[model samples]
Target: MSSSPATRRMSASQRIIVDITDWNRFLFAGKPISGVHRITLGLLRAWKKLGLPFEIIRHDPETNRHKIISHRFIEEDFSEPIHIGGGRIEYSYNKYVQRRTRYFTELAKAKLRRFVKKKEVVHEDFIEGNYEPQADDLLYFCGAGWDAPETMHAAHKWKAQHPGFRFVVLVHDFIPLINKVYRNRLGTRQFRRWFRDAARSADEFICISDNTQADFMLHWRRCGGQGVPRCRVVTNPHEFLSVSDTRNQPMSNGELSAETFLANRNRRYLLTVGTLSSHKNLERLLSAWNTLNFFRDPEADLVIVGDNDPRDVRSLSPIRRNVFLFQKPPDDILKLLYMNAFCSIFPSLYEGWGLPVGESLWFGKVCLCSKSSSIPEVGQDMCPYFDPYSTEEILLALTNALFEKDYIPSYEKRIDRGRMKSWATYGSEIHTALLKMT
Candidate 1:
């Protein structure tokens, strides 16, 4: 995908326009940052730091239009500290309030269906102005876009209006499309529609890993997509979050300090970071721990840190006493967890790029990971791996990692941090690739 020197430079009037509609939606809903969001934020930060010429735009679904967004606006929002209920009682009370709100909302919805005429929920547009596209500008969606049909429609419209404009979509994974079990009927249908629309609208595509690129091509052919667009693989940064990042700020009074939290645990805990989604294979990992009777050890524990789903929590009910779950932990606490953990584990059955594996390895920790999909691309031979499908293999791997005295030390010694690319490097490479495409 290399371009000749002549076409690698951007003209004075040209600029890259980043679409962060997904990020805005998530922020409005008070959602926790996911891996994809982190990747987008990292790139944005890198580009800003390196003085890359770029403008930010967000597609307003309510207005069915795009608007210019300032980088400072997003940066300030990220800089604000997160407030999660810290104490056990406060956390319990917050959970109670959430449950009550959900229950009443559902009840009201049921009543309204029976007694009231249904009407469309109107939304007020808060964005100041609509974005007018420049012919030479590169329009890119770096954040999640599968759920934004309106945004995709707008992108398609713009591409048609401005023939010289290039619209690029970043494909994270084909999980909902490839694996039916991970999503419901409605979710699967939505994803199918999104992929078709996104692929149809884009002039070019970017995949997080080589495996993801292969998956994209396979599905593109299956769907009978037209002439292939220029696609590239730009693996995400492996570096961990630094203190300068917004998430590393001090917690509020209600939240537990990492040092105090670890002191309370008073045990060497193994860390696993990721949402308890079906694709994460948490059940298999838990089974491996159970089979080894590792939970019976008083001095050892398992720390599960990630956003939690009610259905997933129900499915994995009656969690072991030694298995402590920290739902939606702040980044600072998470960093300390990684720092103090005995080791880390990533048992995801599939991923575009197993970020937790890279994060674990970044801290010089041995990450017992699944040898599936794009996971191996993140850790390679630096960490041990096991088949996510087989409980026997998971058990064996866990046993070896726990029992072997030199297991963690051996991996730490070989961690070659020099090989890991920083976020600035990742952004620069992507910027260069975009320039070449133009």
Candidate 2:
């Protein structure tokens, strides 16, 4: 026998289309590719490996016009135009905004136009009843948000028109749930509406963690939007490590290996990795570390690996001289740091899913994480947990994880758990889920 088939069989399957917005880049100027993108690419690769025929479609907003450009990745062709209004003019007025917007917008629109013009035009608007889906085609929307209500409405309409086709949506975060308190300029009503519509329309909702899925469910119930699509928890997959490649390549930006950096600096220190944002609670971590005398040793360093936010710097003046802040290091260096660090400290106020906790465990690093949100889920008992709200609690945890000579529980359990949850295992789970969906 070949194997057991898990995915549900469709009545008349034509082709699978995996769609995403901003598929080219990862989380908010962090990297061209990242954890989510890696999983997406991995899924595509897995489909190909299994000989599953599918097409990848990416819809990017056109900078100059009120439209969106769609490309068919499998055919290397572009499809019909999707009219989505652009907000370039309004965005350009903000002086603090990065200048790369114009360049990126123009480049995306040009590339999309060229690709579409070269391919057979499908001018039918699935959203506006310009075209109807055939029994064979299925559309999977990944990392889509409520910000585009029209897209969701269109997908729902198309699904209704073609009952045989599958339409799935992947929810990356419950942003409104945790970020509602920080609604300064972004209208709270608008954000809530987007979340409501997304929960209502999606056929299948893919959540990055069980905690996220539960949060969505709770919010949906509270909003009286029951009977939403089935929410499934799928842990994001990390790139499989190649021992040889990691060994051969320079870990840092060719500056210094994390091991070497730590060796020269000091043996005792608490490390944190993330962009310097309010949610990260970096200042609190620093205050706690200072109070505990965790880094009293003159050589000890509290190294942070991420870009510092100017807003945060302004709010918390007199930046500590001992706190070494480096612009985001490359992945290899990060992995090396996790492998060698005395302890990894993450005191985020909230997280949809704590990636660093899982990552630190994967590298066998003792991690000190906050009990808030999904951090506990990611860290479990493998990490030494702390109350993010209490400076004293965090300080105590930090002190023990760093100075205790026999602090081996966290490290041992991290290695054990990391070994159990490899990328291959994550891929297998996804493969099974996709198969079941079919």
Candidate closest to the true structure, highest TM-score = 1
lDDT by residue for model 1 (1-438), tens: 121122366789888998876665455445555577778778888888877778877754333357776566445445333221111111111111234587467545544653553442223333445689878888888777864554677777777888888888888988877663275555566667677777678889999999999999998966556887679998877788542243544442225444466768766888898776778888888777776774444356777777665346445645456666666556666777888889899998899998888888787888999998999899977888899999999888877777788877887787877767677778888888788778
lDDT of 2 at 283: 75
On lDDT, the leading prediction is 1
Model 1: C-alpha RMSD to truth? 8.1
Q: What is the lDDT of candidate 1?
A: 0.71
Separate clash counts for every candidate: 2, 6
Off by over 4 Å in 1: 1-7, 77-128, 242-259, 294-299, 309-319
Q: Number of clashing pairs, model 1?
A: 2
Clashing pairs in 1: 86-254, 86-255
Question: What C-alpha lDDT values do all the predictions have?
Answer: 0.71, 0.57
Q: Could you tell me every candidate's TM-score relative to the true structure? A: 0.82, 0.71
